[model samples]
Target: MKYKPHEQGFSILEMLVAMSITIGLTGTLFYFFKQSQDSFVVESARTEMNQNFRAALDLMARDIQAAGAGIPMFLGPIASKDGGGTNSNPSLNPPDAILLLYGNSSFSPVTVKAQSSYPAPTSTSSTIYTDIPTTAFAPGNYILYTPAQSLMQASNLTDYAEFSLFNLPSTSAIGTVSSGGTVIGNQLTPSTFSINPSDDNTYWNHTMSFPSSTSLRVVPLDEVIEYAIDTTSSELRRNRNKAGWVTVARNIFNMQVRYQIETYDDSTATYTASWIDQVNQAATNNRALIRSVEVTLFGRTQMSGSGDRQGQRAIAQTLEVAPRNLNLPGFAPNR
Candidate 1:
C-alpha cells in the first residue's frame, strides 16, 4: 500500500520525559514497600517481647506460690506467738513451746533416730528416761517428760534450766574433753528455755546451745533471688541460691521485686497486709516479714529505628507469689 511516511522515532525531549516519569513511579513503590516492611518488623518484635516478659513473670509467680507449700514437715506452725508473746517481747520465749516443729537445716545437730530402747511406753510418764547418757543421743531425738523433769542435761551432768537438743554439733566452742572427764568449753547458756514464736533472729544464733539448752533462739536464714538488667550488654540476669548472677535474657531492660507481709493482730482478731520494697536489709526490717512477692519484668526490642518503617517496642508484666519461708504462722495472713 502506498501511504505517506510519518516520523519514525520520538524526539530526544519526549524520551527523556518518559524515562523520568517511569523512574518516579518505581521510586514511590519502593519507598512504600520499605515502610511496610519496617512496620511489620517493629510490631513482630513488640509482640514477642511482651510474650517473653509475661512468661518470665508467670514462672516466677508459680514458683513463689509453691514455696513452703505442702509437706508440713519442712515448715513450722503458721502463727508466731498465738496469744503468748507481745510485739516487744523477745521471740525466744513463746507461751506454747514445741521442739523441732520446723525441719532443721541439713546440717542440723538434731535428728530423729530409730529407738533401740523399745517397748515404747504407752503412757507419757513411762516414756520419761532419766539419767540417760548423752552419748546415746542422736540428732532430732526427743524424750517426753512431765514439763517439770529435767528436759535436757549436758554431757557433764550440768543442770540446764531449759534446753533443746539437736543431733548437730554446737556452732560455738566452749571447751573440749581431753583425756579426763570434763574440760571447760564455750557452751551457750540461755536464761530461759522456750521456743520463740517468731522465725526471726530470736531463734537462730551462736549464743544458744542446742541439745544442752532448752530455750530456742531465732536463727537467721535469708535466701535471695534477684533478676537484674545489664546496661552494657542489655541482658537480664538471675541469681538464685545466691551462688552468683547469670544472664538469662538478652534485650531485657528492667526487672523489679515487690513483697507483701501478712500479719495478724491477736487483740483485734484481724489480719493486715503491707507491701515491702525489700526484705533482707535493716531499712526494711518490718517489711522483711514478707509472706508474698510480686515480680515485674520489662523488655525491649533488639533493634532501633523510627516511624512504621523503623521503630522499636517495649513490653512489661507483673506477677505475684508466696514465699515458703514467710508462710509461718505469725507471718501468714490466713494461718
Candidate 2:
C-alpha cells in the first residue's frame, strides 16, 4: 500500500485507537441523556404530588373550620375513627377517619304532627309525621326526631328533647307528595327510615313511643361530612351528606386525625389542653370538649424504585383547624 497520506489507508493500531475513542464518547453521551430523562420524570411526579396534596388539604381544612357551625352544643359536632383505611381494624393501626356534622340555621326545626314507635326503631312505625310539609326534607337530609319516651338525657340539661337521627321521609320513602307539598294521612313504609345511631348520641336500643306535637321537635341537619383514606387504592376519600365516598386525591398513602380539647385537671386544680388519638371511648365527654382538630396526611409520588429512586417517598403535611362555633369551657375568644 502507498504510504502517501492522501492515498494510503490508516495502520491497524491507529484505526483501533480511533474506533475506541468514538465508542467511548457515544456511550458517555447516551448515559447522560438517560440520566437527564429519569430526573425529569421524577421531578414531574413530585410536582404532581404536591398539587394533589395541597388541594386535598384545602378542602379538609375548610370543612374542619365549619364543623360546628349552626349546630346545637348538645349535638356532638365531631367524631373520629382511629383506623379509617380498609384494613382499618382498630387493632391493626390503620389510617384514621373523621366525621363532622353541621346544619344550615335557615332550616328551622319542624314540629312533629304525629310519630309512631312500634316494632322498634327498626320498622316503618318509626315514621315521623311533621306539621310542616315533606317538601323541605329530601333524600340524604337528616331530621332529629324526639320520641315521647327517650326525651331526657342527664348529659343534656337545657333541652329535655332527646332526638334520634333518621335519613328519610323525602316523600320517596313512601307515598308521593300531595298538592299541598305534605303527605297528609300517608306515612313512610317499613324500611323507609333508617336510624343513624351515631349521630349526636347513641339511640336507645329499645322501642319508644312518639310524643305529642307540642312536646316533639324535628331538627334539620344539612351537613354530614366524613373523610377517610381508601387503603386499597391509596387515595383520600370524602363523603358528604350520607352520599357515597369520592376520591379527593390519588397516591395518598395515609391519614391521621387527632382531637384537641381542654380538660380540667382536678389534681393540678387547673385546666390543661391535649391532643388525643381516639375519641370514642374517652373518660370524659371527649366530643363535647373538642376545641379543634389536627390532621396529618401522607402523600407520595407515583414512581416505583428502590433507594433514592423510590417513588414511595412520602411527604407529610399537618394542619390544625379550630371551629369558631365550637364551645370552649373556661376560656372564650375575644369578640
Candidate 3:
C-alpha cells in the first residue's frame, strides 16, 4: 500500500467558530444596510418637500408681484377674505382666502352691430352681433359683459354677465389653405356670435336694454383670481373665473394675510405704514390705504420626526410683497 497521508479536516469546534463568525458579519452588514435605507428614505422625503415648497412659493410670489396690474383702483384690485381660525390657532385650522384682480390687455369696448336686438331678451337663443372682427374672437371662448349703464350706477357686481361663445360664422379673411376647410380671416365686421346663455337673471338682459351699436364693456372673466387653502385636503387651491378649485400645492397647513397701510403725514413729512389683519378695526376703514401685503405660510413635512427632529416636521415662513401697481398716484388714461 502507498503511504497514506492522514486526512486533515476542521474540527467540530473550529467549524462552529468559523460559522459563528460568518453569521455575525452577515448580521452586521444587514443592520447597516437597513439603517442606510431608512436614512435615504427620510432624506428623499425632505428633498421632495423642499422642492415643492420652493416652487409653490415662487409661483405665489410672482403672481403677487403682478397683482393689480392693469386693473382699476376703484375695482378693489386686491381683496382678502379672512378664514376665521384666530380664536384658536390658525395652524390648527384652515387658511385665509385672498382674491387678486388683474386685467386682460386685449379687452376693449365692443359695439353691438345688430340694428335690432337680433335675439330677443326673452329668447333663449344664444346669439349676439358685435363689431368685433371675425378672426379676433373665437368660438368656445368666454366673454364677461358689463352693461355700461349698470356699471355706472351699481356699487356691486350684480350686473356683470359671463357668456360662453357658441358657433361663430367663419370667414376666410386671411389666405386659407386648400386642404384646410376654413382659415378665418381678421376683419372688423359685424360678426355674429351665438353665446351660451347662463341663467335667467343676468342683469344686462333683465335690467337694461341697449340701442343698436351701443358699446358693451367686454372683460376677461379670469381676471379675478382666488387663492385659498383647503382644510380637508391640506392643499393650496387656486380658482380663476369660477372654473373650480385647482390644487396648486400640497402639504400646506395654514395661511394668514395682513395688509400694510401707508398713511402719509404731511405735517411730519413722514409716512406711517402699519400692518393690519382682518380682525383689526382699521382694516375696513383703511383698506384703500394698503401699500403692501404680508403672507404667513405654514408647511408640514411628509415624514414624521422623532425626538431630535420633532420641530423639523413643521415649518413656518413669512413673505412680504409690495405690488407695483397699487397705492400709487398715477393717471392711467383709457384703462
lDDT of 1 by residue, 274-312 (tens): 774443222222222445666666667977776443456
| Order of models, best lDDT first | 2, 3, 1
Candidate 2 pairs with clashing backbones? 84-95
RMSD of 1: 14.5
Q: What is candidate 2's lDDT per residue for 1-335, written digit by digit as tens?
A: 86756757899999999999999999999988977877787888889999998999999999988775654433346777775443443324578878776765666555544334211233224655555443465555554533222222122222222234555545576443244764443333323233232442323222221222234545557777878888899999997775578999999978888887655655666656777786642335346557678898887889855644544656888888987665454333211
How far out, in Å, is residue 305 in model 2? Answer: 4.2
User: Which runs of model 3 end up more than 4 angstroms from their true locations?
Assistant: 1-27, 73-75, 85-90, 108-222, 266-269, 279-285, 305-312, 330-335
Highest-scoring model, lDDT: 2
Two-way TM-score contest, 1 vs 3, winner: 3
TM-score of predicted structure 3: 0.55
Q: Using TM-score, give the best candidate's number.
A: 2
| Alpha-carbon lDDT of model 2 | 0.60
Cα lDDT tens digits for candidate 3, 1-335 = 89988969999999999999999999999978977876776777767767767777777787777775543332234656566565556566556767665655555434433345332111223344444442255422233233333122212222211122222334432122122565322222223232111212231132112222233333333355667887787787787655678887788878888877655554575656566664221322233456688887777777764633433456667788877665353333234
What would the TM-scores of all predictions be?
A: 0.49, 0.68, 0.55
Cα displacement (Å) at residue 140, model 3: 13
